[model samples]
Target chain A: MNLPPLVQGFVLHFGEMGSRWGLNRTLGQMYALLYVSPQPLNADEITEKLGISRSNVSMGLRELQAWRLVRLEHHPGDRREYFSAPQDVWAIFRTLAEERQRREIEPTLSMLRDALLETVETDEEKHAQARMGEMQALMEQLTTWFTEMNRLSPETLTRLMAMGSRVAKLLELKDRLRTRSG
Target chain B: MNLPPLVQGFVLHFGEMGSRWGLNRTLGQMYALLYVSPQPLNADEITEKLGISRSNVSMGLRELQAWRLVRLEHHPGDRREYFSAPQDVWAIFRTLAEERQRREIEPTLSMLRDALLETVETDEEKHAQARMGEMQALMEQLTTWFTEMNRLSPETLTRLMAMGSRVAKLLELKDRLRTRSG
Candidate 1:
């Protein structure tokens, strides 16, 4: 850990937070270093700064790349690959959400869909299917909304969220007007 | 594993997803069994149904209770405790989100706040602080929005999400009207 105290604080925190967010401590530390680095960092630099084994850093970088949380970079005439995180915070958030949805939520949803389609021969099976149905419906609603939200520009999404509860009020007004007109 | 094929499939899926979602395989299996069970299950019943050891069931149940994902119940004249997941899918989702927010997100946000306040002595520290600031601002926006959304009725939330990108159009219309009036 050769980082300045200020930068080290964040790297350490993310290292602790990594498992909670589906990455290990080393991956978290590696990603944090890349995120805060002013320039893209190569494997050797990451290994030296974090004081981890070269193989560990190499494996962690590969894992980060798999998650799409870190990007590989190349400098002209440099043989070693460099890595950096997406600089835009919004882009990072979107990427994380999409990746999790793909990896975790989508599998569960597909499994539920298949389970829901199965024929039931007993009350237990019927009950299980019904519960799965409810879970599937909710997931479908959320995933549909997320896909739609992904189409919006980050600025638009931010503005919409900034409205907070006010958006509910807008929906209510629209509902009341539609009722009267109908 | 004494479950019917229909229910067992879902349980196995959740068990696999457990580690990804911050719970271990046993905890996921326990919760899924409870979630789909028609009646509250006692420890022995869960142990037998899942064919796991008594101690593992005890530990998994305790872990679920701590996560607030399972509720404890008692039947008249029975000394043994029973457990069941909330029947409402929306409630389960809300509880899961809130728990993860408190355990995972809140700490990171607090750490970022403190890190952002620290004095910087070098260009590297300054750049790191700037990155932290960006991350903090985005997190604050998201947490605020999520907190507000949590206050809404599930039906309202479903409707709001169903509105999807349409909400962006509503915001755009509001902006245009304000510009015209101004």
Candidate 2:
């Protein structure tokens, strides 16, 4: 692979981190390449730059598209499909969060709910159900919070995040005001 | 493996879901077993219940301890160490977040910082650096927010989460009040 040294370094590092992020090495490297490139890259360019097989690039692009991490574009008068990472980083982050919730968190929550519905035949079942209940409650709360936050415009979300835990001060103020009014 | 049916079902599900959470199947199953069991369990018990080899259970337990997901204890007269998941689900969630930040997020941020420090010889390098800067800024903001939240007592954290995006309304109110005061 004859990528620029900087891009090469990041691609390799991302590939290594891929498993931790629930992606395989090729997908990570492909995404990293697209992410850092100045222009949308076709599968042929990707294969040549990354020294990967055509089929592998095809597969990786497919998976990335499935995750909503990559977008397909067509160049003027060029029919070959090109892939590019989302231009906005926050949009990329939001896509990842949404996809992971749909693929992993939502299914796990559903499984817990199903388990909770089953009849308990013994003390062991009761204890297991209780554990599932705790986990389900935690998951529901987090998912609810994410769902609410996801509805906000990106600008609003950024402001809210920038506020950070300073929002706690607001909460404290609200509580004090309520106490005085009551 | 003679696990109770309900416990077994959850353990198997966790094992399947483990890779998505950056854990192997064995680690997920072992943690699941400990989480659902009413009492602390020793390695032998885990091995028998999960039908994994003794060595696999030992390795899994060692890794789980490293992740701070399991606590080790000793019985009054028994030499074998017993392991249990933290009783509070929030505590488990916190440990997982802290560990992931340390292992994955922090290192990625550091890598981005290092990349940003490099001299750019070409437009490609310059563009890549800009992208890296954007990502670094976003990550810094997120880590800062998490650090601030982590400082709050768990009780306060719970309250903030329970408040969810209602906090956004508070942000709006604060903005309105600031406009009047200014």
User: Which candidate's DockQ is highest?
Assistant: 1
Candidate 1 local lDDT, A50-151, one digit each (tens): 999999999999899998989998999999999999999999998999999998899999999889888999998899899999999999999999999999
Q: A64-161, model 2: which lDDT tens digit per residue? A: 99999999999999989999999898888889889989988988899899999999888877988999999999999889988877778878778877
Runs with alpha carbons beyond 4 Å of true place in candidate 2: none
Please, what is the TM-score per model?
0.97, 0.97
Docking outcome class, model 1: high
Error of 2 at B153 (Å): 2.8
- Report how far residue B71 has shifted in candidate 2, in Å: 0.4
- For candidate 2, the share of real interface contacts preserved is 0.67
Estimate, for each residue in B78-143, the C-alpha lDDT of model 1 and write its tens digit: 999999999999999999999999999999999999999899989999999999999999999999
Q: How does candidate 2 fare on TM-score? A: 0.97
The DockQ-derived docking category for candidate 2 is medium
